[model samples]
Target: MELLPTTIVAGPSLLTRASALDQVVGKLRAGKVYRREDLAYVSNAVDRHLREMVSGGALKRLAQGLYYAPKKSVYGTLPPDDQELLATFLRDKDFLVFSLSSYNTLGLGTSQLYNKTLVYNHKRHGIFSFGNRQFDCRVKPRFPKTLTPEFLLVDMVNNLDELAEDRNLVLQMVVRKLPGFDQAKLKRAVSNYGSAATRKSFARWQDG
Candidate 1:
């Protein structure tokens, strides 16, 4: 007589899956962002646990493979920190974040208030939104670790077309303001960060 073959089971059983999910959830800290792979070691079924937690509001998916653990305050749940989100998304700490309102500090008479936030990073390019917040990420070949007066001026000209000011008036002000900035540092910033059009324009400003 032929003996019957025993069937083999493939993945974790429901009880084991539940235990793994419990372990994964136990590791969460509020107001922190996580990459999917970050919790993989804690769960045999990380994707399933993530899906279940997302469905149950234990996690908020910020992007593909990205999640946020919301923190509660007296008012309501707080959104993930911008720095933390960018750090997780880019997987790099080399980035510069600033608002368009920073142009006003340049003293070129630009006072427009903008709600937009710009992120200069070497890794990603495009707009990403988290809840009510939006980050406009631009991939730059080179950017300063910190914002500088000279870098801001070059950046302002590079993005002049996008600003809400009169282009000609701003150009005039920029030309006049050139004399006010450190000639050497401003030239270096323009050489390093300026767009072709900005470089040409600054060349004329410097020559004249």
Candidate 2:
């Protein structure tokens, strides 16, 4: 019976891991969203810290590698801020988030509403689910920092057929409404932001 020396490999202690978790959680902005990399500056063991936090009810896992500290309400946990999540996902502050429902504001003979939100950016393109909402990331060559009425109008026309309302009637109404917009700005938007088909469509309306 021989007992060789028992070897214990020393790694970070549970206390150290707990401290890393605390540091990571403490640095997160409540009601805001974060990604694993966003918290990497605080702890290299981010995945473990996040997993423990989620298990402890200190954080909510929104999606793969996405998390929120949550804002409490009598109703339930409020969803993470979409703007911050999208910003983190894209890793750039240069993107536009607009509700597809804004198309209803065009007064194009339909108050039809949609549940999806549009994310305009050059970095990513796809449909993603965030919290309780659906976000459609559209990659564009150029997009304005802030949406303008002229841009909305052009975008509505560009996506007209996809809308639920009477496409022809909405198209006709929008064509008529075009006359009411500032001619210069409308033309510029069509030229810069509008697709080739959109430009052709606008030209047809302008001529007739």
Candidate 3:
């Protein structure tokens, strides 16, 4: 049997790993979602540390390989923030996180606010749960890193059918507001982000 070098598996290296893990754990902001790999660089025994952390109630596993060091309040342990959770799940901060209810604010006659949220990400697609809330994750060809009014206007028209609103009234309002939008940006959104059906519906307005 070959004996490994003493320096290769020294106590100092183990201590350093432990120290790094402890530092990262101590600094983990409450209500922030994290992946196991997010802290793997901190320690070689990261999985062990994570299991222990979960057992000790120091962290909550939100999903497969997803976790958060919770925030306690008078009501209960507060869930991770929506944007923070989405960023961890999608592994990209460049994605857009928005409540579908935001479309209501476009003044397209959508008065009923939706409880749903959506994620426009290049990495993931589907519905995912975080605590009690669910995010409808979608993959898109071209989505702006941030939300824009022009994008919202286009998106509102694009997703018009899916919304729980009066379609005819909303369409009337959309038509009325169409000319007020930033022409260049709206055109790009319709061509890029809008679905085929949406683009077809929007084409009539563009032609007028």
Candidate 4:
């Protein structure tokens, strides 16, 4: 009788997984946000690693499949940066995030402090909550990569109805301030990003 040699096939060891988990955690940076899918290439068992990390407080789940590596400040834990948070959430870098309060900086005679933060993107449309902050996502056909005074002026007029200030008063102020802006840039911004009502209002204002 001939004895057949047996070849042993061993599965991955517990140590191997632990090491991989460590590698996964090591790649995360404080104050950054991530989606589980973003780390899939980092480890074979990313979901399991993420679960364990979340349980161990090494990572915080911001939303479904979203994680944050929180940073600590003198005050307390710092939230993820808005750019990073949105970049991870939408899985796209082409988006604009701004607070309605930013309109006040345009010197348009608007003094209201708006708590709302609006995100304009092509991917997602609707509100989303991440930790304690909420972002209102609006899908727009066109938006600038960076905010500009011209864009803000057009956007404010577009969203005039949603503003808390007296719409008529604000519009009056916008009209009065129109002469101060570069006509070419203002017209281009209005043509590109303004709503139908906004376009008509701006056209009438420019004509006058």
Q: What residue pairs clash in candidate 2, if any at all?
A: none
Q: Write the per-residue lDDT of candidate 2 for residues 41-60, one digit (tens) a residue.
A: 88878777788888987888
Tens digit of per-residue lDDT, candidate 4, span 147-166: 99999999998888888899
List clashing residue pairs in candidate 4: none
Off by more than 4 A, model 3:
1-27, 43-45, 72-76
The per-model lDDT (C-alpha) reads 0.91, 0.83, 0.81, 0.90
Sorted on lDDT, best first, the list reads 1, 4, 2, 3
Q: Give the Cα-based TM-score of candidate 1 against the true structure.
A: 0.86
- Cα error of candidate 1 at position 192, Å: 1.2
Q: Model 2, clash count?
A: 0
In order of appearance, the predictions have TM-scores of 0.86, 0.87, 0.78, 0.87
User: lDDT per residue, candidate 1, 1-208, as tens digits?
Assistant: 9999999775667667777778889899998999999978777778888999999898999878999998999999988888898998899999999998898999999999999999999999999887677899999999998889999999999999889999999999998888999999998999999999999999998998
Model 1: lowest-lDDT 10 consecutive positions: 9-18
Candidate no. 3 TM-score: 0.78
RMSD of each: 6.9, 5.1, 8.0, 6.7
State, as a TM-score between 0 and 1, how close model 4 is to the true structure.
0.87
Query: Between 3 and 4, whose TM-score is larger?
Result: 4
